[model samples]
Target chain A: MKKITIDPITRLEGHGKIEIFLNEAGNCEKAYLQIPELRGFEQFSIGRAAEEMPRITTMICGVCPTAHHMAATKALDDLFKVEPTSAAKKIRELMYSAFQAEDHLLHFFFLGGPDFIVGPQAPARERNILGVIAKVGIDTGSKVIEVRKRLRNVLRIIGGKPVMPSAGLPGGVSKGINEEEKQTIIEAGEYAVEFCQFALEFFDDIVLKNKDYVELITGDTYQHRTYYMGLVDKNNKVNFYDGLIRVVDPNGKEFAKFKGQDYLDHIEERVEPWTYVKFSYLKQLGWKGFVDGEQSGVFRVAPLARLNAADGMATPLAQQAYEKMYSVLGGKPVHSTLAYHWARLVEALYASERLLELARDPEITSKDIINLPTETPREGVGVVEAPRGTLIHHYKTDDEGILTDVNLIVATQNNSAAINMSIERAAKSLIKDGEVPNGILNMIEMAFRAYDPCHACATHSLPGRMALDVNVYDTKRKLIKRLQKNSCTTSTSGDGVGEAVSNT
Target chain B: MKTIILGIGNPILSDDGVGIKIAQQIKERNPDLKVVETGGVGINLLDHVIGYDRLIIIDSIKTGDGTIGDIYKLDLDDLDASMDLTPSHGMNIATTLRLGHGLGYDTPAQIRIYAIEILDNTTFRESCTKEIERQIPTIAGKIMREEQLCAIHTLGSPLCQPLQNRPVSKPKPRRAR
Candidate 1:
């Protein structure tokens, strides 16, 4: 049997490689996603002051710095044994909600939207944001840019920056919204809610209305029956910022709920020699490889997982949207991975509504934001629902507030095992008897794309965009075909396989 | 004419920070150039580049076509050849510009890219490779000459003035991450 490697998985914010082994009959036997690890992150943080973590740790991820910043700050609070004032909490949540809205909107329209909006089988060139604008009209594109801009502005006003926020402190945030800033944020949040509502309607009209797309969403290839995890408030409502970690089984039954500090007791990491990314599974259920079911410990996070783990949305409109989604999708604990898109929109609406609510609060403008910590520093854990999934930051510091040890469980790692399962399942099911159709690549990509994985930090960079090279081999482990982005061609001389086929 | 000198890269990632370092040098020499450092990619870069009459971008390139510290002066068309919509960081510049124009945004009329060939973008560090870091001022000077801005050497322009002190070595890299 020959091994196929798709080096540098394309269209995601990270560098991942998918290797599929083909049996003698040419059908797929096994597939694995290999993710390279960024070197020396733990060594990089050693000896750094504990207070600098919020700033330093946020740089770990380019896409979700706000999530890192929040988690690090909350960890700092726990480390110092201090609580933020009510005003500080509101201000922090305000910025966080805006970030959530911006991130979700980006993923849905720019990253993942083309798959559904422009049609799954659409040509490579037409399956992007430009194609999306072409189908939805230029006005909708402009509206997207406007809403995203407004949401970013809201983050800037509160966090004092556009991309990476620096407002988080041990006890609270460094800045608070003034009356004028409050009014501006209020308007922006209100607009965000409206924009998300419009987005939901658009999805309903275009995606749900199409029978083929619905069938694809509910298809067996994309379905995974496993545990789902997220953060929930006191009412067991979906919460992005501060809450206890909640896990639900495949049947939508509560598995366990625990504070952030108790993560090690409920979850465990398994390692493989082929990849640097550790596979995370439930501690109690034990590791069961890549299989998904109640028997298997494989679980997922991000939008769909968050929704399934929670009872309902916190806001009125988002609650309605949530109810509508479950009803249409055939009930709770929707196992379809493609439902992540719908769940993302519902989350965006919730984030927007929460932003507006926080913006309108009277205490949002209070000057007493930070409650300076007076206790000795030790170790603590902080958890937040990153737009991608649940993000956990744990740090150990000396009494001098100097960092001694640090460990971070990023959102993507939580779903890594499941992502591999999704990819393998899709690949096995889609590629039959050795003949791969034209759109096979996109179909395989659709499985992991739903997770919105971030691997840029994990892989090397090309000149501009990373080009994915898919190499197929024969039973003798000799190269058979080479399919690459932009120019897919048969191997001419090197690693000679067979005659050429140029699809792109 | 309204112009923007954009430096794009991940500052936390080793040699990738070269673009931003050069952009900062340019800003220090001539504050009137409207320099902006961004880690954003694809459409996010569009937001910063639009509404300007002319744009000059400094970024690190890994084309394997040149040696480390080798500089290439490219235009918008060159980027068109390098367009791969399936991107991890952000969209390629050409796609971003096209999207900006298609959406009826005010994209810059003239665009020039100064890309420095470099290695080691995967490491977590606050500084660029020493070889590339040494070329910051040179790259800054190249942009100034191309843009026809008042040179630091010969200038009584509004923003150009003789530096009271110039550090011989590369400036200590700040923790932008």
Candidate 2:
């Protein structure tokens, strides 16, 4: 049997190492996914002012600041018992949609796009968006920049800034949009919708052209059944901003729909000795281990999980795409996380359609963008569908409006268990005993990047360098292979690279 | 001439956000001073310093021997290989600064940086240790005095003589009921 270990998986957000131990018989014996850093965000926010949750939590992540901001705001709002006005809600939704559009575009094009477009084994120097741009020409790069710029402009109009907008407040937003701003937002929204449509065509062409990737598409093969979780509107349309928590069983059956505050009852965090990040699972399901099986509660989040949870897309084009995806996945739960990119594109289409609706809504032009109350309740929960997955921020406060506790479940946390599973599966299937050819390990790491794990923001750490080390040993306890790579340095852009590779 | 002060640091990461906090304090004293908070070394930095003729950058520097709150007046031209300025972002600050200079948009004519020596950058908790927080007021006061002195010096200089006695406009009063 052979044993292989990859320490500090490269191109990921946080510090983590994966070790795969195989016995003399060449079968997998044990797998360990380790996250080195401890999460102290919850404990640190205990004595802060309740109203500062949004701003404070925004610091949790530079990549997904909007997620932390929205969740923190929502939690504070719940505590305060403040419901923003119609215009306020509309503005918030628009800002969030803009964030979704920008963030998803960043992930799909800059982060995940390279994997599909550029072959995985391409030198570390040629595995970045810049490298892809050099090969593909300026037009593609300009498209991405244009999309991000337009999205940032839209978000700026409402949120006050593009990246970490300071708009959200406890009761409502701090600022309101005037007529001129509204018109600007409307124009930008129209442009975004058009851009998204163009991107859909672009992605469709790419998907059709790549037959190898097409095989990964579910339809009927691979894991296509698992529990689903997300938010929905009263009419059952997909809601990204706010709604009661809903969970559906593997067979498209509704399991539970509970208020956001009630999440504590169903979800319980289980700490594994290997990883610092805790694995949250259904309280009743228990830890059935990482292997795929019934009652595992190993449901994932992201585009795939969101699509599975919702009935249909809010927009027509997205709905059509959703139908196509469902048909391909054999109707419901898409367990194969590899199909997340397809789901992301479909959701991007949906977000564009939703933008058009909001832009057209007459109320969007109104002057009353903020509705804040003088007093608020002592505790609250804010939940939103972040680009990566569902994000929840729970905050409790003292009588004097001081924060007593803060619990955050970021998008990366939602996929914690699923990430481990993907790593294990990829490791077992790809790594042969003491040998994982160069770039094969990179592929396993790519599986984690599919979720775009934001360990920096999730754990409230400033962005830092990441290193991955992999070791392989033979049945005789002889070291066969050892690999060490830095996540940022390996990619040409000094950012994480995502590419697919095949080793013969 | 309008001056923009930028504070770049990770606020939760111990000493990172010190620059921003100092800028905020200076802004409170002089509301006209545009104080902006930024996460260091990115395209965002390029955007922030675009039109500023005079920019004051405040950040935390991990110099081996300097006292925690020691102030330094750095010359942009003198920024050679010897300086130990570390950008809080992934890319090196020197590289980003070089990129900005290469872009040829009017780089800051005079850029001053006040760096605080950092003790710890790993914690997520807010509120710097008492030693660091105490220096905030003194730093703010020093920056304010420097601006006033610079304005006076500029007025007195023969090269910038456009009528030194031009009436100083009074700041708009806060609206009262």
Instruction: Report residue A388 deviation for candidate 2 (angstroms).
Output: 2.0
Compute DockQ for each candidate against the true complex.
0.20, 0.07
User: Once superposed on the true structure, which residue ranges of model 2 sit more than 4 Å away at CA?
Assistant: A1-14, A26-28, A216-225, A328-331, A369-376, A458-467, A471-480, A486-504, B1-7, B16-36, B40-46, B49-120, B127-177
The residue ranges of model 1 lying beyond 4 angstroms of the native Cα positions read A1-15, A457-465, A486-504, B81-84, B87-89, B142-177
Worst 10 residues of 1 chain B by lDDT: B158-167
Best by TM-score: 1
Instruction: Write the residue-wise lDDT of candidate 2 on B1-177 in tens digits.
Output: 657787777777665567778877877766656788875333346568767787877666543334566554443432322111111113223333544454355666667655455554446766766777888887677655645522444456432222233346544668998
Extract clashing residue pairs from model 1. Answer: A13-A455, A13-A456, A14-A455, A14-A456, A15-A455, B42-B91
Q: In model 1 chain A, which range of ten residues has the least summed lDDT?
A: A495-504
Q: Compose the digit string of candidate 1's lDDT tens values, residues A1-504.
A: 011111222232233466777788887777787765676678778789989988877677666788989999999999999999988998999899999999999889987888899887776666678888889999999999999899999878977776677999989998877889889999999899999999999999999999999999998989999999999999999999999999999999999999999999988998898888888899999997889889888889999999999999999999999999999999999999999999999999999999999988889999999999999999988899998899989999888988899998888889999988988888788667887554556776777678888766332233445544455566677666655453332212222111211110
Q: Per-model TM-score of chain A alone?
A: 0.92, 0.88
Top model number, DockQ:
1
Candidate 2: docking tier: incorrect
